[model samples]
Target: MNNNLQLYNTLSRSKEKFEPLNPPNVGMYVCGPTVYGDAHLGHARPAITFDIVFRYLMHLDYKVRYVRNITDVGHLENDADEGEDKIAKKARLEELEPMEVVKHFTDRYHKNMDQLNVLHPSIEPTASGHIIEQIELIKSILDNGYAYESEGSVYFDVKKYSNDYDYGKLSGRKLDDLLENTRTLTGQQEKKNSYDFALWKKTDPKHLMHWPSPWSEGYPGWHLECSAMGAKYLGETFDIHGGGMDLLFPHHESEIAQSNACRGHDPVHYWMHNNMITIDGQKMGKSLNNFITLDEFFSGKHKALDKAYSPMTIRFFILQAHYRSTVDFSNEALHAAEKGMQKLFNTVELIDKLTPSSNSSVDVQHFKDSLYAAMDDDFNTPIAIAQLFELSKIVNQVNDGKETLTASDILFIQNLYSVFVFEILGLISENIKGNDDQLVDQLMGAILSLRQDAKQNKDWATADKIRDELGKINIKVKDTKEGAVWNIE
Candidate 1:
């Protein structure tokens, strides 16, 4: 029992039906990292959030072409072109080349995403590689009178664009309000108006990432990369464009302006944004420096974490709250997620061990229908997970032989687990150790024999090493349960 899905649209600020541009086919784009530093927990938001979207669309039998870009160039430290490129700044700080810094951090980003089990996108183009496309977009905008060149730099004429179209449709802010409250600095002597944004910025002689353009020997503006790269790979119009809610302001907003100005149409059909991950109600961000990297959190290397959480637990925690809701990280919250994940997986594991009866104790029809309804309503994962718990209760009762399921019902339960939990939501049991106790028993008996032999010869070093190695593999071997025995740690 499957139903068509609905999701929140950031442009309209409402939950809407997820209608792809092409029937049974979709093109998706999400803004990727600047790759200047380690990937923190905050960086995992859009990656996992949109990954769920990508996975679910494929489950629906839609041919989805997902294109997430690698922003190897042209992200300014501050909002203005006068500021340094973030990658260039990191390179100078670490005494490395700009591309070297990007590669190093991008590798780390991929590793972290892999740990969280995110599927790689179909096309991942880089900003630096798409310079010709970006230049063409700038030239088109200039010819259309939406952009103008002054000295060596080109700026978008916001005031001129506003005359023809609603410049603030996505963020829902008036152009005059944006112009009024916009931060002004000493760099505006060349801009036609304070609201104008850079299209191509003139680079200083010291800049490492500069490229030759018609206006000057400069890099593309920060927003130009996404507009150019997304259009090149996904075309002038795509099905879905997603990013963190923080990008809704100037970043995504600017992309809308530059791409629409050049192409004469909106780039994305449906816009999705995942809300922020907050730490005690304050946003965990790079500029704020309140972030703990994903590696640090997993290893419990950060001073704030009480213990390391498994990657699956982290995935489940984010899913418990809807993507659009801000999930605050706390020791209590994480502990609850860990407990729930273990409980849920344990139930799924026990399903195969259960035997069915003539009649079922639980109402399978009602349970399945409610679950499908929850998912249909804007992908309400929280409610779907709650239904999973209901299934868990039935499974436990049936395992206790107080309740029963038919053979066909058991197969239905397994199918639901595979399709909805694993494929649709991208949540799977990552526990490499099999659930069977006998496997652990055979391994532990062999290991303890080695320990005993080492102990008999007074080779305490060898015995301790054996124990330490077993501990690393999550097996706790003890010297007495009559003799040394082990349990899963």
Candidate 2:
């Protein structure tokens, strides 16, 4: 197996060679979406980012049990831990049950992810389904004396946990800084320290989502579900844990503390985080109210979009940048990505049509090696994409008869494009409707045949009329030595 894979470990603040605890057995857990609304562009980053990691690991012949949880139970509004549960609030507003709201948005999230071609995780556990596990985890933490109950709510003693283990190791936050900078929320009176987070939040009588726990009738905290579910599925210690960079501070930090307090050890070996997406140099998030939903991008229904962008265009745009770098959103950038994606797909389509020569002009092995090298370096997809573009150039050159490729070279290039472009990158050609495409082909063939007859008879006016009619529909027709070619604009 290839052992040169290196990834950025947020825990250590450095890039380290990936050495799994057990060879060919990798366990990874990424924080999944909190399903309260339509998933926006900001949500796609971590999904695609960890997806690349998941794909590459499996490609390397690793048995990866990837776990991504659906937040159906306990995530609060604004991460404040005081407001109503996000799903419950939505449910109340929509006049539906809490689980009904969860089902609606969870289905929407899955649909959007499917459109993006992201693979479904091996295990997708919901917090509501694992309430027993979460309560057990909280019990373990309490037994370790890292948590305490006050006013029917259990809060993690960040001050006490910090005394035994470094509380802010993952996010590089100090306990002093957190204590000083922590905002005053409504429920601050119940905790000993301002920075101490809730393990279980006691719900009010009107709160829709509540369960019977040792502390009170309440739900688990946002951070506790991930810690509990991950440990329950991936064991106390796993290979990797990942989420957005924004989650590094209290969410992941608290996870680290809770896992240590419960199991007497760290939960994850490598910690990874993907940066956020921005719009106009400002973070594009639902809280910002400037975010565009994935559905809006696909349908071009928003006021900001000039045209609908295909799912592959969005995926390619995200992959064009390193996962750790911020991807700024703009219509112009997306349009450029659409063109580039189309060009790459066109080259791949042309590959099968090219006739082989006696000699090869491109070094196929060197190209493949460079692609793998880019992926090996922290899954540097932008560098890998650049390599693919170079290979596309070679394919174009050979197709245009400007260069040459032997039969072996043709097969290697085909396989290379198949694996990287389709499998790893998760890009696929957009499917045109079969009946519509066939109808257009038949009509174009008939029209061109009539034009040929008209030109043969020196009927220039008739041929010009046919060409002008097609042009009006945004279809450009070009005459080549082989025949006439056309494309829809």
Candidate 3:
């Protein structure tokens, strides 16, 4: 196995060679969804990004225990710790139990991930289920004198924690700047500083979600869940902590403070963050009222979609860009990705039919080296994909009798695609839109057979009508020497 993988660390702001804290055994924790709404394109980015990390790490012969948390409780409406809990609000509006809402959306989230071919994490712990763990974590922070109880609510003392340790080192923020720019919101008089975040909130009688803690009959704060659950599953110091770059602020920043105050050191060795997906140069999020859910993209229900995009096309579109770079959503980009993905798969299918010669014209060893080299350099998938396209050209040449490949070289290319495209990239052949679907292919074959019969019988009207009617529904039919072919336009 080639073990020269390097990944970008958000803490140090550099691409560092990945060396696991414990050899052959790696622990990774990622912050999962809040589960109040549908899984959108924005959510897909981190899930697919960390999934590639998870897949590639295991491919290198490492035992990885990946834990992704489900935030079923304690996430409030704002980062300022004001307003009602997000899940509770959803439950109240729908006239359903809080857990009911959590279960419904969580199931949908799992379905979306399955369609995208993302693997489930080894341990998926939920915040509501781990109340005892979160409470115990708060007790440790309080005992360390970094938190204080105020009117039945416990808030982390950011100003006090700043005195002993750097409060904003992970986010590169200063306490002075935070204090100066902080707004004094309503119901914040209980805290010593406006920047101080809630560890445990004293829920009102009307609040939907509440638990009994030593400080108050309330729930844990939004940021406390990951710190508690991560330590429980992956130990106090884990190998990697992954999430979106949008969490680099108060959420992840507070996690650093809580871990340092309690355990007296950092909890994670490497902090990884994936960039956001955007629309019209703006971040596509539910808060912005601009996010297109995965269902909308798959079903073509959104006003922004030109046509329904398959799960594989969405995956390919995302992989075409580096995880650290912004991917802007556009119809043209998606259409091109769909075509490109089809071409790659078509070339792979053609490789199996090539006649092997005595000697190879293509440099198969150099091509294999290029594939590993792209993945080694921070998992640069776009570069790896480009290399595959170059090989696709070679595959086409071999099929066209312009280039030659020995039997061993043909086997090597087939294995390369199997590992890189199917295993590491997590693309499913059955989900690749058109020709890969057996049912659709069978139906199109029957329809084209009827059209060809009409043409052969000298019935010009029937043949032209069959072709014209299919075009009305965005399915184009073409006449070639091999008879008739139809495709989704």
Score every model by TM-score.
0.90, 0.95, 0.92
Clashes of 2: 0
Sequence-dependent TM-score of model 1: 0.90
Task: Give the lowest summed-lDDT range of ten residues in model 1.
Answer: 480-489
Per-residue CA lDDT of model 2 for 1-489, tens digit only, reads 666899999988899999998878999999999888899999999999999999999988999999999988845677545567777877888899999888989999999999999999999999999889999999999999999999999999988888889888888888787777877687899899999889988888667899999888988887988899998899889999989999998889989999999988999999999999999998889878999999999999999899998888999999999999999999999989999998898788779988999998767779888988899999999999998898899888987899999999999989999999988888888734223678789888888988889978999899888888989986667676567766675
Which candidate, 1 or 2, would have the higher TM-score against the true structure? 2
lDDT for each of the candidates? 0.84, 0.89, 0.90
Query: Any runs in candidate 2 off by more than 4 Å, and if so which?
Result: 79-82, 431-444, 452-478, 486-489
Per-residue lDDT for 60-135 in model 3, tens only? 8999999999989945676535567788887988999999999999999999999999999999999999999999
lDDT of 1 by residue, 327-388 (tens): 99997898999889778887888788788888876777677778777777777788999988
Off by over 4 Å in 1: 1-3, 79-82, 435-441, 445-473, 476-487
- The TM-score of candidate 3 is 0.92
Candidate 2 to native Cα RMSD, angstroms: 2.2
Model 2's TM-score against the true structure: 0.95
Error of 1 at 441 (Å): 4.8
